[model samples]
Target chain A: DARVTQTPRHKVTEMGQEVTMRCQPILGHNTVFWYRQTMMQGLELLAYFRNRAPLDDSGMPKDRFSAEMPDATLATLKIQPSEPRDSAVYFCASGPPADTQYFGPGTRLTVL
Target chain B: EDQVTQSPEALRLQEGESSSLNCSYTVSGLRGLFWYRQDPGKGPEFLFTLYSAGEEKEKERLKATLTKKESFLHITAPKPEDSATYLCAVQANNQGGKLIFGQGTELSVKP
Candidate 1:
């Protein structure tokens, strides 16, 4: 059973701190997506990469948030100078050519 | 702009009860409609994908049906273990594979 994997399931940081979340997509998958989920906004797409290249990041805050897929299996989302409003669960999903996304367990981040 | 809306933000049902969740969507062109189940503190799990009107799919106690304007997830005799947030998303014909998600319906089954 192959599944997307994420590291640091939980993180707590003070305001202005930097937070990084990591994901390892399923082997042989070609598309990766980053999403943020909160009670107020539901699920918001932050970024996505296809074939190891960024296809979209318009939903991300360019001033503080960054998403990168260094290689086919690894993807990362980083937030610098994080604010309290940034508290939420970040999810990473990978998809094959068929486009059905498989999501990881998610990283819960709490910024105080 | 593509948009997806789910009705009854929260629902509660007794064990062995039956109910349906609604998801309405508007897009330039529909590529696919997807259903996902999310547990507390976990990411969404893929459930079903409907590609065209009148398509139906079933898994255990859940069945999903899609129409031109909306989709319905029917739960029959649901158990406590079926409690979770059900999410609906749509992929537009022109948006590549990016998904537009709805607010989701949180279902609670009481024993």
Candidate 2:
């Protein structure tokens, strides 16, 4: 079955470290989305790319978080100087023109 | 501002019981409404997508209906395997396909 795949499903890092999560979207999907899930805020869109070009990153912390689609099949979300409050599950989803997104398993990050 | 809200933050049901979850939204113009099921420690899984008022979709034991201001996910004869967090999200025509998500409704089904 075609599915979005993510790497490093679990991560434990000290505060102020840099964390990088990677996603491989299903082949031929045109849109990729990055989201952060926390109990307080629920699921929040951090950034997204359409056809390998970023469409929005306004929801992300400008100085600390970044998302990029280096190619059609790969997307990445990075956090610099990650903080304890940043500990949450990060999900990557890819969709076709129809707009139905399929999500990856997610990366659970814990910063101490 | 566009927003989505789901009622009854949590619900508990016995196997074979039927119930419905509600999702209300307000947006400039609706593109679509989506339903997803998320298990503990997992990403949300796609369930249904409703495009307009009076639109309905169904899977094996689940039915989803959409209206102008809200949507409903009706579960019939639910099983323990159906226990999960049900999330509702809305895509607005002006928002470039970004899904505005609601705080999910956690459903627990007991055998």
Candidate 3:
């Protein structure tokens, strides 16, 4: 069955280090979304792209976080100078316009 | 700002029992409401989507219905494997497909 895939299912990094998480959306899907889940915040939308172009990143910290879709199948979320507060499970989801999103297994990141 | 709220942060039910989860939302315009089931340490799995009020969808033992301001996911005769956190999200007409999610309701099915 077709599904979204994420690399480095887990990541551990020291504070101030740079962390990058990658996602491969399902084939033929044109929209990708990045989200962060934590015990305190529940789930928060960080950014999303449509047709490899970012539609919104307002929920992300522009000073340290960046999201990009290098190609239709590859979407990436990076954090420079990662902080302990950034520790959370990051999820990637993709879908067609106004359709149900297929989520990846997610990358659990722990920043010390 | 668009907001989604799910009631009963957690729920426990005996096997074969039935219950419903509520998701209340406020948005400028509702494009779609989505239901997802998430297991520990995993991503959210899509369950159903309701586009308008009075719409209903079902699969297996789970059924979802939507109204103008809220949605409900009804579980009937749940199994142990049905234990998971259920999430509700909404796509607003102006959000460009960005979903606003609820805190989720953690359901536990006991035998």
Candidate 4:
């Protein structure tokens, strides 16, 4: 079955530590999306890329969070000096033509 | 401002029960509305997509209907496997296909 894949399904880091999450989108998808899920905010789109080009990162905190698609098959979301409040599940998704974003198993991050 | 809002933040039902969840949205130019089912600790699974008002789609026990300003996901005779957080998202035509998601409706079905 073709599915979006993510590594390091769970992580725990001290506050102010750097964390990197990886995703391998389904082959042939043209779009990638990064989202954060929390009890208060629900599922929030942090950033996305179209054809490996970032379309938006405005929702992401520039100082702490960054998303990139170095190639068609790989995408990454990195957080530097992560805070306790930043502890949440980060999800990566992919789609063709950017219509229906198919999500991978999320990476749960816990910052102390 | 573009937004999607889902109602009844949570619901609990017995097996074979039926119910409907609502999603209201306001977009500059509506490209499409999507529905998804998310299991705990897992990313969302795609359900349905509606592009026009009065549109409807179905699969198994789920059906989605769209209108001018809102959409509804109906679950009929639901099973335990149907329990999950149902999310609603809207795509703006001018916004390059980024999805604005709702807070989601958490559903639990008991045997």
State which candidate has the highest DockQ. 4
Model 2: per-residue Cα lDDT over A6-72, one tens digit each: 9889999999999999999999999999999999999999999999999899999999998998889
| Candidate 3 per-residue lDDT over residues A1-112, each given as its tens digit | 9989998999999999999999999999998999999998998999999999998899999999999998887999999989999999999999997678889999999999
**What DockQ do you compute for every candidate structure?**
0.72, 0.77, 0.82, 0.86
Runs off by more than 4 Å, candidate 1: none
Each candidate's fnat, listed in order, reads: 0.61, 0.74, 0.74, 0.89
Please give the CA lDDT of all the candidate structures: 0.95, 0.95, 0.94, 0.93
**For residues A1-112, what per-residue lDDT tens digits would candidate 1 score against the true structure?**
9999998999999999999999999999998999999999999999999898998999999999999998887999999989999999999999975379999999999999
Task: Return the TM-scores of chain A for each candidate in numbered order.
Answer: 0.97, 0.97, 0.98, 0.97
Please give, for residues A4-102, the per-residue lDDT of candidate 4 as tens digits: 999889999999999999999999998888999999898898998988998899989999998888888899999998999999999999988847889
Candidate 1 docking DockQ: 0.72
DockQ comparison, 1 vs 2, better candidate:
2
Could you give candidate 3's per-residue lDDT for residues B1-111 as a string of tens digits? Answer: 899999999999999999999999999999999999999999999999999999999999999999998999999999999999999999988678888899999999999
RMSD after CA superposition, every candidate: 0.9, 0.9, 0.8, 1.0
How far in Å is the alpha carbon of A81 misplaced in model 4?
1.5
What is the TM-score (0 to 1) of candidate 3? 0.98
Q: What is the RMSD of candidate 3?
A: 0.8
**Alpha carbon lDDT at B11, candidate 4:** 95
Q: Please report, as a residue range, the 10-residue window in candidate 4 chain A with the lowest summed lDDT.
A: A93-102
